[model samples]
Target chain A: MRKIKQWTAMGLATVMAMSLSACGSGKTAETTTAAPAETTKAAAAETTTAGATTSTEPVELKFSWWGGDTRHAATEEAIKAFQAKYPNITVTPEYGAWTGWEEKQSLNILGGNAADVMQINWNWIESYSQGGKSFANLEDYSDVLDLKQFTPESLDLCKVDNKLMAVPISLTGRLFYWNKTAFDEVGVALPTDLDSLYKAGEAFKAKDPDMYPLALGEYDRMILMVYYLESKYGKNWVEDGAVSYTEEEVKDGMDFITGLEEKHVIPTLATISGDMADSLDKNAKWIDGKYAGIFEWDSSASKFKKALEGSVNKPGQEFVVGEFVKMGDNNGGFTKISMAYAVAGNSKHPKEAAMLINFLLNDEEGVKIGSTERGIPCSAAGLKILQDNKLGDPLTIEANTKVMNYSKFTLDSKFEHNDLKANPDGVYYKVFGKLSSKELDSAAAAKELIKGVTDTLEN
Target chain B: MKSKGMRKFLAENAGFFFVLPWLIGFILFKVYPFASSLYYSFTNYDLFNGVTKTGMMNYNKIFTDSDITRAFMVTFKYAIFDVPLKLTFALFIAYILNFKLKGVNFFRTAYYIPSILGGSIAIAILWRAVFNTDGLINAVVTAFGGEKINWMASANGALFVIIMLRVWQFGSAMVIFLAALKGVSEDLYEAASIDGAGKWTQFFKITVPLITPVIFYNLITQLCQAFQEFNGPFLVTKGGPNGATTLISILIYNNAFLRHKMGMASAQAWILFLIVMTFTAVAFVSQKKWVYYSDEDGR
Candidate 1:
């Protein structure tokens, strides 16, 4: 009887604690829900109707994107400007860093409470379009979009099977960035060709035996750079419709990088320190005149330059944006859509959402706002506004112009290798990552990579 | 006679009502998930597309796959190196703390803090900071006129660091050992001293035997916990320096969440479960020869 009483008391206490926790969580949910509704109601009162003298009821559109703090601030400013111009359309801005954005967005989408407009990555377009069934086809809204203003290649990137999915907000192209001080100290000029680049690296190493000429992170980016080099050497190692390499050619590519390591031209995998943020920190090696060169996308050039500027020991740092290196005869590198902004298909206010997207990407005021934050805007009008205002980092403008002039859009050969159909991020990194460390040799590595990719693709 | 049967049923099954909540939870959360994962193991279960039966293909692939083998070997290595070291350290610390000392409670709490934050993100971040090439450990070594070691850069080095991390969180086991030590009567020590036994002899004979059951319990639990170690490897090494630290749990996580290969991940999970179960069963079977219960009819 006593044992029974003790058990009952313990059970009751457990129940009470659980209930208390549930209540606490419930209150938070209630507060969030209530606050949003009140603001949204006020916003709805201000939205104007088209062709009416008195503006249609004001509509509040929530916009979310993932970016750094500077981008977030700029986006918030843009929202304020948009609100000032429309007076009727109240825009709520949500922004965060790259981490956790996808998971948070997934939860919102699943709950049917996603923001009206969202910044979406290119790799996720197909997944989101199919899995969530939550993106509207923008074909019907072409009149408002002015697609002609965008480069046909850029415009086409956002389309899947002729169904316009989203508007590209930026174009990102990879380029080689050399540390001017490091090169000049070794009496080597900027290399224009792959052979010259290799020669320069060797020269730099000869001058200073202790320092590595190149400090590459032992991650996917390094492998991708190898692919870029192979393409430049006139071999589309994994390109569609191109002759696929025999095992020897793949080994050759792997050996080339490994040879660089042996010669002390490239830093051992251990020496490369810092994540993307760490690289952007004040005293990072890349910024502090340590590495001779690095491969970076145009979109990040501004951030890198900013970090360089903030470094304590300012070596004469200069950026040279070169074409993606070619190996044999191939001139093209992987070019895909950057990121896009899309309205969820299930959104109650589709027209309002579309209007917000149009205003952000195309309208004169909208273009001005985008120029400040959204990487070199996708729309022609947005580009013009950026050119007029000179709002973006000067290096980014130069890089963007150079890419526009010299580059050709090409498909990533390893796109199929991406485990998008299964895991959205693909097991590509994990599989190839292991191989890079020589955990498996070239033939075995290829077999495993092929197996992992095929398993997901076939399924 | 009819009433007697009713009373007997209530008496025999009284523990069920007392544990009904846990029973329900076990069924709903643990048992249901376990059964569903078994079903999933035989399917091509992508979370987004749902499931499709694929027989023993994932299992077959596991044997043939290099990554899976690496994961298994890495985890097995971690278990082998970590368990014994951690147990030894825990036993030593527990013995020291069992002494009547000044401010023993304060020392106990200080040692217990890391265990509280054992699997926390902060600790994982701390681990990275201490092991990074330019990090505190290397800094200290270099300051001491020694070459800096890349603790988290190579496979063996990474495994060493992870084992140290596991061993560092020996407080909970130590606490249990301390409690068991207290249960070892003062009379036993007095009797041993009267018999002219030294302190060491008293410890090995009287104290250790008395606390064998508790030590066994701690060993089994810690071993299970060590096998499920994901965060330290996942965050500190990122299962790299050549996939040296890619434990099976990390692989399962990568497949299920990162790759969305839920079926393959589920299969890996079951394999881990079996490995843990086998180890635990071995421990239990061995306990009969070692574990000393105070009440000697054994039950």
Candidate 2:
């Protein structure tokens, strides 16, 4: 009797363990059973978009993006308008600030539970969909999406292995933006070139010890290094998915950053870290016009302008777009797709997701509502609507104009890989950070930088 | 007869049925992840890509990589500084609060509040605010004719700030110590006084021995917690001005989520787990010499 009782207990425990281990297969079975229903929904969406009688069947989609409050509000309103047009379809909006959004979205994609439509960074195509599988091929849904509204160059930026992974929303580039009030307070003319920028840094230091001509964060320092090297060498930062600069060339770029620090052209890493603000726009010194200029994205011009305008020390500060200085004979900046829309490959309603993308980019109502909140629209129709209605932020348009007209370099996707650009452990962060702290000299920093990037590439 | 046998079995196993939900949760959430991570530690699982078996590669990298070495050193330094300082601070405060005083309950609650809110994001942000260059600490320093210190910029300063965060959250340990202190009999102090011992002597010779068991408990718990510390470093210094405070937990997180190297992260986690377990085992082995329980045959 005792032996039978012990055997029964052991058997029950085994049953529990087996059931728990079978959980993954059970989930797969449930998903397999649900596929037919999703297939029917896709068929219904296709027939509706094929100009047949529109289906009254209810369809729900999840669309997610990350942005500021203004962009979130605009996108949410556009989603509402989309729902109004497609009354049978319910679009759930998942939006938040940019911080941690990438990680969350990446996990969602990996878990096979990504949103139907998502606002994705350009590098995500290379990161999450490198093999052209994570995201739905946009070309397949071109019937509903109207890919021609976007330029071929913009479209090319989103393609991997002949598959359109995402549709580019807008192109953006880094440019200098100066606080005119801060420059005027320092009694110095705005810097137009590298020499004058150095002189202005001296002038600012002489007049106000706390003020500096410009401030570039660690990642910004990396970008500027690339720009400097690209301008001098006239080569892409990364060529054929490898570090293009030699050890000596990388040393020169690192030296340039160190020289800027020595001349007080930009604050040291210590100063920026001490500010305790995660981004320049939120830094108190930036708002108060102590850090007179920033090397920032044209898409983010309005945010800094607004932040300075709300400054308590110098309210209504004049924040103007400044020209990109020539680091070498060539122009120093590269234009990048600021953001894009992509549909998950596993989304149940690809056609409907394409329709939502189309409505946001090509539909007159959606375009008007969105305006240039996410930078100037890449879509020809969308840009025309914004231009005709005069609905764009003037500062963003000016900065965008400068960025588009000046930048000639190509930015490789590897430059922004997570391992290379991550906050602390990233190559850019560690190498530049060590340099700023004087723990690694320019020569050693250069070697480390190249080695880190090479290691990432090889892996 | 069969019904009676079924009833007997059900009655005998009632306690097991009562704990079934927790058991299921433990197996599903804890055991599964623990086993899955172990399996992935020996593979090349980049989270997004499918897993590929690569025996010992991730472990080999952990042992050889300079970055991991730095991370382990930083984590060990953090544990060394944090555990002892926190335990001492907690014991000191608990000793003070053990005295009869006015509105002692309010003081206890106020002191305990930090530990309650210590692990939260808000507290981490508050720490940043307090230690930043222009923060309140600097304001106070400057008012006293001192210069501002870059607390979050320098590697040492950043590590100090993180240690301070851990030390400031000594409330839980203090509460545990307070309970242990209260349980110490007044008769021991009286007997010590009759033997011409001072108050300090009484505390050292009498009270401390009785509370060694609790001290051992707090030490083990805190040592483990310190090894796994993440929020303070992650939110405050973000593991650096130059990777100075990049603890193992932060490294694991960076590898797993940011770098997408789940296998590497798993390997790092396993190594950290082993370090903690070894420390705990050593502490248990060493406690036989120092820790005295009243129920033991010491007298």
Candidate 3:
């Protein structure tokens, strides 16, 4: 009896130890899977439809995307319409805000259980489909998808190893947007050049020490730095998968961002961190027009504009599309495919997925409903439909026009690599965070930046 | 004769069949992943890309990479600061609550609520709001004419916010301490009082030595949990203001999920395991000097 009790106790001890250590793998996987399921479940509740069936055999498809409430509502409506049109097909919608969306989506894809149709970031093609097999080739579904609606060049941008992994939804690039109301209140014109921008900063600081003319997060600072470098050297930030700028040039770019902080053109990293908002649009200072300027994607202008609607300043005049800052002789920024719709390679209904993509991008009813929520549609048919109806957000269209005409460089695939751009731990975060916080001098920060870029490229 | 004996032994242990389901699940879910993680630490096993054996590369990188070293320092600082303060606070609260007082049960429930919600994402976000420069803490500070502190931006301040979050959720430890406090005999305190010992002296002499075993248990458990903490730092500061709050778990997560360096992440996980084990083992060894058991011969 004593021996039996001791054996039982030993067995229980082993079980407890195994269970405790298992939390590392078991709990991690559970959390990863649960994160998406909870978000998507909540989102699905919002977009669930009860359409009447007209066919005996029904096919179900899952579609996923990440955006603001406006995009969510628009996509939800379009999905409902698609379900109504194809009574034989049931579309399950999984959508949420962009926070941690990529990590969830990546895990789902790796697990071979992603939505049949996915709204993917442009860089995902290069990152996930390195061997050109992660996503189903859209060209293979040309019979169902309107391949001709997209430009060859736009389509080429989504190709990896000759596989047309996705079709472009729209083109976008970052541009300066200023709060004219705040600038006018400060007795300064909205800056159209770098010199004027620096001057405006000083003027705004003199008016109120608490107020600043601009704010840039770590990622924003990195992109703006690239634009500054490209404008000066008239070259791509990364060329042929290698860092193109020398260390001194990288220092100059870092200096420009730090220079903005010193001149009060932008708030310091410390000040922004103190605000504690995850993104600029959510920041109270930005919403109230204290921080007057932003360099953001053309497609994202409406969200910023919407955020400032209740500002103390004149609501309509709060978000003004400013001209490209004349930092150097060359146009600095690059345009890339904003986002795309792709069918998963593991999806059971590739044809149905392709049809849904077509209906959303090319079908007139679908195009009108989705009108400019995902920027100006890259599809010719979709654009024409919106044009005929005199539809689309004017502010977004204006920003897009400015971006299309101004940006001259190419955004390399490696520019948006997770290791280079992820918050806090990524190279961009570390370099910009340290520099703006005065932890490292410009030369050292620049060296670190180059090393990070080189390491990502080599990987 | 051997077959007959085996059959008889199997019949004697027929009840083992009842636990077979649990045994199978334990091996499949717990044992497999634990063993695979050890193997993965030696390879390049990004989830999307098929696994490639790269012996020693991931482990070598852990030793050589400056980021990994920095992660170790931050994690150690967090554990060192968090564990003692949390234990002390829990014990103090438990001691006070152990006294027969009005509505003590309500207070216990209220205190335990944070332990339930503390590790949640919602609480992490709430903590962020309370510590924001324009948040509740700053509002109070300014109301008292104190200057605002940039808690999220400063290195030490960022670390403090995350550490305080762990310390604030001391309810679990407090409850355990409360239980152990109840177990201490009332006669010991009565005897100490008869000797003219004050309340503090009685606590140190009678109450404490009696609960040393419970304290040791709490210490080991809290130490292990502190090393594995992820959500607070990830959600609150995102290991930011120049990686001040980048704990080992966050580093492991970033490598595994964000950067798709699963092999490297596994290596980091194993390193964390070893660190936690070492701490727990040390605590166990040290307990021999401190902890007292009534049944000392049995122990």
Candidate 4:
């Protein structure tokens, strides 16, 4: 009887843990932002009761996205506006911060219970869609959605074998930004060229040993490597569904990054990581002027600039876009979809889902309400609408426009594999981490990286 | 007469109906998933498209992938260190708590607090904060004229933090050990003390022998739990600083959800199950030689 009791207890514990893990994977997102489920359910319940008497066939659709307060408010306002225009079609808004969003989405997809109208990353359509049925083809709802508002080029990008898997929201890529005040304090001019950046790093490090000229994590280093190889050699990282660069070629890029490390041009892996912030925009160290420069997405430039609030440095004018370090004459900076919004294939209200998506992307009221929340609307009409209203953050618009004018390459869908880039021992982080941290030589890391990249791409 | 009496008793009190909810849950959640996961191991089951049987393909892929081998090695290293160290710590604390001292209940509760908080993602996040560069540990270190340690960024340091998290949650095991220790008759310890045995010797000869069954229970639990540790590494380092702390459970999770390779994850889960079962079986077999109960021989 005692043994049975022990077994039962153990069994109970295991079952309880299984349930906890189901909820635990989303813990990061939940802690970072309010969970979307409760709000979505509440909105749905309210809509159902409100429409019960008069509605012939009331449709309630779930629309989910990842965002901060600004985006959430804008998205909710859009939904409210959308409901006012079409009272029979009630839309429940689900939104949260980006952390753990992918894990939560994957679980929902697996259970066939994802939101009817979903905002997704472009890469997910490629990874999740097999047998050509992962997400609904919006072409089927052509009547409800105004497909002509999107450029043919933009529409063509989301096609996974002639199926419009997702709608591309906007194009975004990486660039450099500097805390101009930090450089002034250190008595060093902002570096315009690669060589000068090296010198500036040394001067700044000498002036204040606590501060790094550029704070770069492993993932940042990898993006730099990609940009370097692409600019100098005009070669795609992956071409013909395989790795483009040889091990030696990749070695050159790793060696260049480590050379920066040797010159104190960038922080050591340990130093930047010391802050333990997920993003430079949120890092206290960056806000405190310990990090003078950032390598960031054009769409995300405003956040980095804004994070200097409550700091010793002047928040308003201290943030400035930096010159692109001259790698070669070629412009290797690239743009890809910042994120995509899609309709679930299993959605019961496909027409309503498409209608909601259409309203957000193409409708005039949706355009005004959603203004610049999801990185400047992708549609020409929508961008014009936002531009006319002056709804965008000026720095974000300037930096994004700058990168757009400079970029000469576009990333393949395979390049967006999170496993290949961000995970522990991932191609991007493992080799770069080793090189920067002095764990492995450039040659050794390069060889390992080739293997990692090749394996991820092929798989 | 025995058969008639059994029928009468069943007719009089059919209280098994009370357990119907539990029985339904056992079948629906536990047994169904366990059995289906085994079936999934043999198929190419990517949850979105469909499940197609490709017998031995997932197993074959597992053998070919170096990541699986590395994941296994990392998990083994964690289990080997974490299980023994945590159990020993728990036992040590349990021994002290078993003493007839003032505020013993308070001490037990205090020690058991960590376990209550252990299974939370918050604790994992706390562990990350406490070990990061500017974290509490580093703050303490710098206060003592030492440089900040790269606790989360270094390969070894990341592994150390993860192991420490497991050991810190030893309260559950400690509680079990404490109960078993209390159950050990004081007469035996008293008699051993009178025989010129020191405290340590008395502990080993009397206390340890009597608690072997409990130790056996704990060993199984700790070993299994340590191998399947997910939250600590997942929330903290993400098995980082170059996969130095990528527990097998983490690998299974990445394969299943992140990569959408459910077949591979299922195969990995089965392998884990087999490994744990083998360990449990070995412990059970070995227990006969050492574990003693007062009524064992009588039974």
User: How much does each candidate deviate at the interface, measured as C-alpha RMSD after superposition?
Assistant: 5.7, 5.4, 6.2, 8.0
**Candidate 4 interface CA RMSD, Å:** 8.0
Clashes in predicted model 2: 0
DockQ of candidate 3, scored on C-alphas against the true complex (2 decimals): 0.35
Rank all candidate structures by their DockQ, best first, as comma-separated numbers.
2, 3, 1, 4
TM-score of each: 0.84, 0.92, 0.91, 0.86
Worst 10 residues of 4 chain A by lDDT: A45-54
TM-score of 2: 0.92
lDDT (Cα, tens digit) per residue for candidate 1, span B102-137:
998998998888899886768877776777666788
Clashes of each: 21, 0, 0, 0
True contacts kept of 2: 0.56
Q: Write the per-residue lDDT of candidate 4 for residues B151-235, one digit (tens) a residue.
A: 7566677788889998998899999999899898989878888888999998998899889889999999899898899988887
The 10 consecutive residues of candidate 3 chain B with the worst lDDT sum are B10-19
| Model 3 lDDT tens row, B1-299 | 99668656655664564365567678978899999999999999988776867799988888898877898889999999999999999999999999999999999999888999876778867887899888999999999999988896678899999999999999999999999999998998898899999999998988889999999999999999999999889888778778889999988988888878888899999999999999999998988888998898855
Q: After superposition, how far is residue A396 of candidate 2 from its true place, in Å?
A: 0.9
The runs of at least 3 residues in candidate 3 whose Cα sits more than 4 Å from the true structure, single-residue gaps closed, are A1-57, A310-317, B1-11
Question: DockQ for the candidate 4 complex?
Answer: 0.26
Report every candidate's CA lDDT.
0.67, 0.86, 0.85, 0.78
TM-score, cand. 3 vs. native: 0.91
Best candidate per TM-score, number? 2
lDDT by residue for model 3 (A1-459), tens: 744554575567567666656765622111111111111111111111112112234667889999989898888788877766665577778889898899889888887878899999999998887577779998887867888888998999999878899999999999999988889889998887898999999999999986888888899999999899888899999898898999999999989998999999999988887787767887778887788889999988787888888666446556889999988989999999999999999898887788789888988888999999999889988989999999999888889988999997998888899888887788899888889878889999999999999998997
lDDT of residue B191 for candidate 4: 89
